[model samples]
Target: MPKSNIMDTYGRFDVIFKKGIGCKLYDDKGTEYMDFVSGVAVNCLGHSNPAIIEAITDQVQNEIQISNYYWNDKAVKLSNRLTDLSDHEAVFFCNSGTEAIEGGLKVARKYGKIKGGNKKNIIIYMDNSFHGRTMGALSVTGQKKYQEDFEPLIGGTTNAKFNDIEDIKSKINEDVCGIIIEPIQGEGGVVCADSAYLKGVKALCEKYDALLIFDEVQCGVGRTGSLFAYKKFDVIPDVICMAKGLGAGFPIGAVMTNKRASVLTHGDHGSTFGGNPLACAVGCAVLDELVDNKILDKVDDKSDYMVSKLKKLKEKYNIIEEIKGMGFLLGLKLSIDVSEFSKRCFEHKLLLITAGKDVIRILPPLNIEKEDIDKFIIKLEEVIKTF
Candidate 1:
């Protein structure tokens, strides 16, 4: 059969996956691969989870989607659940991480405009941090490569050095509307913000009357062994953008805020597909499993095991520079570029992804089995030997 024609945006991987279960995926020819990428950290509960399947199936049988103008029971339940889990008081659902970011940015800007005037519309973003691909989210993303082609980005965004309190202070001014940061920068080589630095940013934002926003799209939703990454640091942000793992494998996103920061009055922001019934049902199911099933407690144990295994690998292979990050959201800094290493692993029937140029991002399913980890290590060791 002739290959189906489609626009090739992503650098195509040689393997075409046909199905996945738990932490394993099968290619078109039925070759098995240990999936460490987990669709870039979207499958928190792993592939084809029975609970998620049942939830989605049940919701679809009734109402797959409905307009956002009316109330949906699933959305309402999910929102309540989210707000209860978070320190925040309200939730705004959207379709993806970028949409959630757009909602959060709009809320911050509108809050500043009404309270601090239009002059306080500036937003502080961190270098090497990623929010999403939409224009608003992309504007605040500090990576040049992603923003190179998209010139003349939305104005009012200032780049600050991550983990550098002084740099954030230098950027904050009377016009600054909010300070947005990733508590644990997932795409920026798995760098975690220092505790003092995070507290300092919060203090600066408070001093300037600017909102503190945490972009936890990758580090939130139990990925960090906590309900949220900011919670781990003991810092409270005014607004938080979450996605990736919120719905397990379902496409969903949310912008949550405290009472003071929930200033987007009626009609200020809206999404046609946001807060629909189907996604919310799946989200609630995922949250139930994460919370009630004690999945979060296991995150620390899995993370430690993975870290210990990676440390041993590092000792045997001088090519590995460091292993960083918390819980299952980890990255291995390699002395050599990760592109070649990632390709070698894929060839050996393991799926991995590269972050930046030198870091290998390991985002396996939160419930990845011990046996899968062993297989992943064997394949990884073989790839290292090839290097």
Candidate 2:
């Protein structure tokens, strides 16, 4: 009944959340809801995790912000860990996924200029892919709805069909410098690029001397039962854009690059709040939980269990057309209106988010138990029956 000073950017529901722990959220009135959205794949370890809390507390007491002129141990440790975990050799830190996308684009363009000069600055993106909302990211993002208002985007960008290598080849040319894609399209109806298709893309990039960029902002950092989703495809990219789950619930982003794509030198790009001690400390804890605490090891089992139940729900409900995506980043492709269905689920106290127009995205915490998933299935079935 009252309006807040916050910008009306999101079509937010009326509920006011007060607290969260594990896979559940509590509203101001003490009503509990199952949080399957997990901050849209950001809370991989769940809300108020002890590891993350401790990391933040310890870092805050020592150092919160420092000039990038001098190195902080936390940032250095995180960079080393990230580079060690992935195929990358260098890292650039930012504050959000969109910032990460922006940095990756900069690296690609710089590499393009270095490799083939100004003429070879084209970036090829996949249709139905969702990269980010920033100007450069929006430019490469293949969805028209998000870009319609923000036209006159960055130059030399083109779109090719997802999972279509031939179409990608047709789009490629001598001036093309980069191809950026999401290994699994979380916001694009949960579409996944096939293994062969990714391999073909990599081959094409190699042949054309173009950099390959994987936007893993939503599906990376143990969300896909692997450290990186690109690993699942068995085709490595030259650059990886990561953010959502990197800092658990904290805001942090990174652009990692293999030796070939690490073109940016000193003063090429930077962020004042990027790689600050506080955020990198939280990122270290997330990585420790996923790698050392063996949290990533359990993701596949949880994914298999949840997907099985969702498949059964599809069999019973005519509204569900298909179950899409991999690992915790799954989706329900419905014949009904997804936005309305998501709103109904919200009323039912099951927090769900919709992808595109017809898919309800499921992005539960990576550490969520089978019991929580069981509860989600029950709530999902109850909502489906109402249709």
Candidate 3:
């Protein structure tokens, strides 16, 4: 990237993808690669899906952009669909995951202040967690590395350990407004919170009258073989943030809230281009493919197959330390250096992404074919042999 034109925040790869279909991607020079990352799990139905294409073509022709001053049919449809799929009573759209997190936090604060007055401003997060990079999101993000230089973020944010119910319980106080957590820690190496632990957290939140927020941006919209990862556990959060795959491939995020959000009178939070016609139309189409067409029903078998194959590879190669994550979001913990291995995989025409510090994450498109998975295994085996 030229410094004159573009910023250098992301350590992006050199390859420029020109096109993609299903789980297959092609570079500008027409070199085909098996895409296992799916744009970091954004394209749930894969690239240029027929449904999204139709939605985009039609909606772009009708209306591309609009201010939030007026209501639109597509926005209402998308919001209704999302709220129907989840336990939320209402939804708020935003531009990205970080924005969604920020919106949720704001709602929690507003709701808390109404219930307990000004003292209830504290929000608790987890260690090794990632919500987003925006200031409000960053304040609650647990890792100090991401929050250090941007010191003095929004105050009243605390940290707790994953799966440690006692630690979470100890942090609960009258001043605490809410607690946010990822049902599955996608950026934190695909770590899954135990069911019992989530239940305990919910109980604690109730005991303290604190709102519970689940950050499902990376694991929602059937990415985890369900509409949202929160369904895996029996507990329900008062507020939840979703993005990444929510709009198929469009840029959109939403904050879903239960009835507790009634405390938010008006103008508590808003976004200008959040639920515009183009994005909402695409979101509706994505939901049609996943929910109406029953595409997610096929994810279980595919996830099981992926796990079976990965374990087989583990049995064959001792370099594999363990397999983590649930459903389609998987991670391979390796005893060997992953940077060189991932680079080799890229050179071998297999796209992959790493998580945390030591794990290789596989967040492929949800509808990837079995043969494509086999091909991924073949390429992975070939790449591992070189190490």
What's each prediction's TM-score? 0.98, 0.99, 0.98
Tell me the TM-score of model 1. 0.98
Candidate 3: where is the Cα deviation over 4 Å? 1-4
lDDT of 2 by residue, 135-196 (tens): 99999999999999988898889889999888998899879899999999989888888999
For model 3 the TM-score comes to 0.98
- Candidate 1 structure quality by residue, lDDT tens digits, 44-101: 9988999999999899999988887689999999999998888999999998988989
The candidate maximizing lDDT is 2
Report the Cα lDDT for candidate 1. 0.89
Backbone clashes, candidate 2? 0
lDDT of 3: 0.89
Residues 1-387 of candidate 3: C-alpha lDDT, one tens digit per residue: 324457668777787888998888998889999988888989899987999999999999999778888889999999898888878789888889999999989888987888799999999999999998989999988888899999889888888998899999888898888999999998888899999999999988888899999999998889889888889777789998999898877999999998876455567778889999999999999889988898899998999998999999999999889999887899999988887788989999998988888899998888888998899999999998987
lDDT of 2: 0.93
